[model samples]
Target: MAGAIAGTAILKNLSPSKGLKTITLTINNDCNLKCPHCYLQYGKESFLVGELTINSIFNSDFEHLAIVGKEPFVNKSSIALLEKMVEKCYLKNKSVSVITNGIGLTNLNPSVANYLDYIDVSFDGGKGTYHLYRKGSFDKIIDSIYNIQSKSNVTFNALHTLSTGTINNIDDMMSVRRFADFKIIMFSPYLNTLHDGKNDVSIVQLEEILKRLSQSTDFVETKESLLLMDIYHTEQEGVSTETLKELMSFYQLDSKIKLIEKDPLNYGIIRVTYDDYVLTPYESIHPKNYTKSPYLASGVNLNQVFETMQNAFS
Candidate 1:
């Protein structure tokens, strides 16, 4: 979640509150594909967040929840958990979204889609370029998108990672917009590589592409996509708690970190790990090898954990 920060201005406005509005639950560490760029720190055994902790989170003040995974739809077990999460969200009057790789999407219960606000399918690239990073599944993912859209009224959006390899086939990737029913095609810079800009799209190149995407009529532009221009302009050697702190210090960002400075009850985005640790999205994604995060037990008061996050980020 905390990878690159371009300038002081960008740091001053890390993200608007809307971007941080959801609490993402990483339900499992199981998946069907082995993408070279996968960010997850895979565990030896399959992991699933317990229902009690999930219910507690739904009962909390967060207005939205996101169900994500190594691939949430990888198996029937994960798909069942997704249905439960969606039911909880509906009962609590909160919106919900699922970010999936579209590996097993068509097999899901059609009724589940009616409760969802969004179904964000991951599209690393398209056709020739996608197979380079994700390997042999571009056609599968594309079919999943088409099938899901035809079966349900759920809003569809595409999440594409712009990397040194994929950027070269920008036209092939953008072609998905012409056929898929994506309301917004979001983009995130590939940040799993070393801090050097070598494996990433340079700021200058990304800027030009962002400009075109912003002005294009292919799909609706989103604030989240526009903010990426700032994220790519800066790069770090690695992702860690210290490296993130240094980036903030170098950018002279103190209370200016408006991203998580608000009351803990309403921090930008909170992440609940597979084992039930409450953490910021940055800590959950980076893990212990890169960052250190407190182990807030599953049943701990949600407010207390939120307070800890406020102190850490604000």
Candidate 2:
């Protein structure tokens, strides 16, 4: 929650000609750590997906691109994808980002570093738990964060996934302080996942925790965290009017925070795998679900795909 970037825009109201606001590419599905909650467990989906060509991503119209995957930095092919996105997507007036574990950022290619707008790094614990869950050197990740921030112009973001175990340890926040100019966004575990984590903290509980974390560090952008936390809640609960109003009233948040999650699939956010499988609305659809539907294609047309999903969900 320690972000200085502007509040997120409601991507659902995109202009068709301008293309989607953001598309998340799992540039590489191979991860360094095999965490329990990872979504790469669908063997059937991988079996059906085809190769993603450079032209396919470069030609796609989107305002922002999030370069993600098993470990985007570690993947050789992802490095190629990043260079292409920087050359193509950045030149076309699109913003590009990468959500990483903060391990390999210090050694990023100059071309890749030059075009990046944001870098979201993950860390669940401050010093102790950070070592346990992620299985990386805490000192090393922090060094990477510091090195990246010092060497690049990109904004920094800290992403934490909360559960019954790590939520209570607030001291780990000090680890985030190393990224002096960073923002923070904590995530809640979801149901029906490749890894169904234990009981998730409720909307009320998350609100309280976010409020507390906001006060914990100046690095945390409390209001933005509040907005995202609320968005997460709305998405999980189907955005009911009663749940929304009550939660908004509790935090005194404006109604516009409701904008982000309303129609995420059509929100112009597509997640393409290394093999070119389009996973729109990363939150709602699982990687394997594409196998269950005809959505798995050699190449996808977003407008047509959006229309199909909208009609089905509507």
Candidate 3:
């Protein structure tokens, strides 16, 4: 809870009025992987699309940046954009991170490797679990991580989708630890609204798994503490509704979890799609009813736009 407050406080200080720090910008919706849990709903046709420019990002005031997907590397221009951002951030002393499928690493580009401060590669369940949802080239993803590590200064971490089928294999996660410095994150399947009610994973089940995982592995970065905090503080107005409150309480969350303030500026994720600037508290775009604001601004004044964001957050 203290770190949560510290994170939020730093975000507020960055742009106190706007309270923005972490910016999640999507270059495009295109991704090579067809992970079943992917919320983007992307396919082959989508991969052909491209991303926004690094020049566009330089105009914003974000201190911490997460270049996310649909697999960011699928686009030919992704490396170019990344290089530009990295050089700019490095010169400005800013921190940048990338979230990828790891397929792009087979012939890793040096520019990307040099610029990133941290890289998170998705590795849900060894090769079998990866192939189940992410389809094709599992070996390539593993190889890509090795390739990036050999060539870059960036820190690499493995990200896994925690599902009923994948959760039991803690050994698979431990296997990845030998190859590189990695951290396992439990994937929350409930965020996917596409799932029919019958097959959905319950809050209780998620809690149990978190409890087990917390006790069992140091390889897995414990995010259960964060979830517990979410259960409490995230229930207030503007964060969650009365129904959500009942649900959190019903799960007996008050005893197990601690709540933290929902820092609109610092803590949540923000995305830039073709249509608008998107913001969500979590990864799933649907459950939160993605908030969009037009990217179109009349005046060329960057300061004016920053002022506008400040007013909106205030």
Candidate 4:
């Protein structure tokens, strides 16, 4: 089978723990809620990635994979794809991870959670602040966390997007650590591509809150994570984003990027969109009209796509 051959090629070169790692894929474009901040070019009815895309993504010289976009748990096909990723990861001792809104996570099939290394649940904030943007019960989100933890040892990370609406959510969101077995609570800045004047939260104000959090608990992430979040939300509003290149130098991610330059086969960002196979640095949750993807995402030999990425980024 094509997938088997691809997995074999990945096994041949990747050590997972030591060799190359990190492959991100948008499994499907179907989600239950319509958040005001959603920027994906496709909508809920968009098609999911096919078998060739799955094999091509895993076959690359990568060890870890990040599942994003819509909600992968909306159907069984997404679960099937995740299971395949997990199985391959287990064989190579690699890792597969996903970022979900936590609605379907409540009754998430045990087989899927067993193979994942990380599960990031996006909880905007506690009940009141949570419902402002996301639809669904905060209780259900918490239940989803318990449901998965009861079944697997996967590290649970709470992903809260800091926006104008949830500026005061720090207190309630961090409280997740008190009740749940969350390994990390990552509060990242929200990028307002629509510029609809709704998510006009201040960066300086956020930094101050982060400072407060640092003094409050050990659950807060390192300075690197904060910087990474800032970098992710930074916009290209005519100010040259080249300074982002310097900001990236402050983190361990810098090391992984160095490997990408040294050997595209070993390390580099591979992003799978509904219509294209993209490489990061050039990828973003930017509005479709303002996208800056460096290459097209396809289902064919994604490994070879790295050569083109290396030439551009490296």
Candidate 5:
């Protein structure tokens, strides 16, 4: 809620020839910290996806690529891989972004910013509760943001998870704008499977919070959050018409914002694992079922995979 939300696009029925807007790759298998809310389970053996696999996707029609890791900058090898990926994206004339924990970023070569379009730092809570959910230095993360902003013109964003805890500490969330210039504050609901039910938030609760915050500063409610609300709309007595009308009114008020009405699986976003399996963004959310579904092999036809994805979700 710190800055104006960008125009939203209602993506649906995209053809394989046009391809996806973005693809997220899990580039590394190691992380410095293990947050309770995160679904990724890091193993002892560290692995970085091969460059061939990376280039294969870059050759496709996707416009952008987003990379994540146990912690992308967790070590020298990981940073090296990230730098290489950024350079590859630059060479391929594709936009690239990364979601980092903001710890190993200090070691990043400032030149990396020349190719990187965005850096979305993950922050679930502010100050007091920052370390409560994830054991990282809160000040260090903020300092890293300040450091990166000074070095380059790359856009910055804060990726947060919404829960009872985050709502209670809403003041801290509001204060993020004071520390750094963030282009957008993106919020996603915490998966019930990942944590205890005490912190679980219902669709009605999420809508109320958005109603309150929407009055102050613009924020982005992710496709996953929207999908959850749709499910709630179908299953429950129904979301209040006034609440829906108020929230939907923002779409008309801001010409830049387009509320995506498509299902999460149809959002033209794919996730590639560290081991090199291509999956739909919806599958990536259910980490427990990551191994249960049949995934497309990264080396195969990516466009064909996209076609399959559209049909399956349609």
Candidate 6:
């Protein structure tokens, strides 16, 4: 994983002189499950506006491509686009990843699975916990995971978001043992503007959860994923800079898990509502101005997009 970071840095330096290493493309906004914490204002209107043509992705210079959305599998056009992109990328020897809720993985057309290198299924927890956040169909999700694993050559990683209601069942979450990879993400209560208006979840609670997760064989001993520390800071106010540094130091000492800083260039990894080719920091995707469809200027050329990003950083 350190190699991934080093490689990213090398690529960042080289990208200005060369080209980008990874490009995350959001194919559509339709989703089967309407998660409570979803940043995308996804509904029929939003979904209609979120569609992007497959040709745009095929023409892009991204070596590693991710097909993501509100629920990428809900949109047949997006899935078709992904199949085409994957086949193209596979022929070119490029890596392709899909971030999905895992609802559509089961019974997927055989051709679709062949194009994917990896699939990240959002498994906040087992049946009970995930239903609290995502509502309705935990069993279906579990079935989807099993079904996808059975059919595809794709590797599966569980993406768990530690939140107020969801964090209590850490032990229960780790009990399920089928995942090839496990990533524990710290939840930002603030992200759900509708529910947690003030977005309050105590730091003591988060630390305790992390401590418990770190000790659990079901979680810590199994495949470890990067800890999202910044999310912890975002929720807790008056958390001095020094305290954050110490917390990071504690994480380094306690776990072998790598810390993935949100890239300044593309915050759309998590929230893919719109497309604006801006050089803004990764965390800045939630900004009002940048969250809509890509500006015509930004969509014109990939080189222009890179130049715009470079200028923003400079």
Best by TM-score: 5
lDDT leaderboard ranking: 5, 1, 4, 2, 3, 6
Q: What is the TM-score of each candidate against the true structure?
A: 0.73, 0.74, 0.67, 0.72, 0.77, 0.72
Q: Candidate 5's residue-wise lDDT over 214-309, tens digit each? A: 543333332221211323232233556455546656533233232333444455667777776787765664455656647645567666787788
Tens digit of lDDT per residue, candidate 3, span 1-314? 11111222222233334434555555565667666455554222343222333444556666766666656677667655556666778787777777777877654576657777677676656654557655666677767777777777766666554455456755564456655555333233223332111322222344444454544444334432223233323332234544444554665443333343443433433444422344333422432243333333222233344455555655
Model 1 lDDT tens row, 63-152? 677776657888888889889889878887988888787878877776788898877777667776777777757777777777767888
TM-score of 6: 0.72
Cα lDDT tens digits for candidate 4, 1-314:
00101111222233322233566667787887765555554533757777666666656676567677557777777766667767887787777777788887765667668887777777767665677667677877887788778878776777665555565666676666655776555655555453212332433333343444444333243321221232333332222244434534432233212111122233344466655546442343443532355455444566666656555554
* Candidate 2 residue-wise lDDT, 129-165, digit = tens: 7777667777887777667667667766666555444
Question: For residues 265-298, could you state the per-residue lDDT of candidate 6 as single tens digits?
Answer: 4322221233432222343324344434343323
Give the CA lDDT, 0 to 100, for residue 188 in model 2: 38
The collision pairs in model 6 are 264-281, 264-282, 275-294
Query: The CA-based lDDT of model 5 is what?
Result: 0.61
Query: What lDDT, from 0 to 1, does candidate 4 have?
Result: 0.54
Model 2 ranges off by over 4 Å: 1-19, 44-53, 184-227, 230-241, 244-248, 251-261, 282-285
All-Cα superposition RMSD per candidate: 7.7, 5.1, 6.5, 7.7, 5.7, 5.6
- The candidate that wins on lDDT is 5
lDDT score of residue 4 within candidate 6: 13
List residue ranges in candidate 3 displaced over 4 A: 1-18, 42-56, 183-190, 193-204, 214-269, 280-284, 287-314
Least accurate stretch of 10 residues (summed lDDT) in model 6? 1-10
- Alpha-carbon lDDT, every model: 0.58, 0.53, 0.49, 0.54, 0.61, 0.48
Ranking by TM-score: 5, 2, 1, 6, 4, 3
Which window of ten consecutive residues has the lowest lDDT sum in model 2?
Answer: 1-10
Instruction: Kindly give the stretch of ten consecutive residues in candidate 1 with the minimal lDDT sum.
Output: 1-10
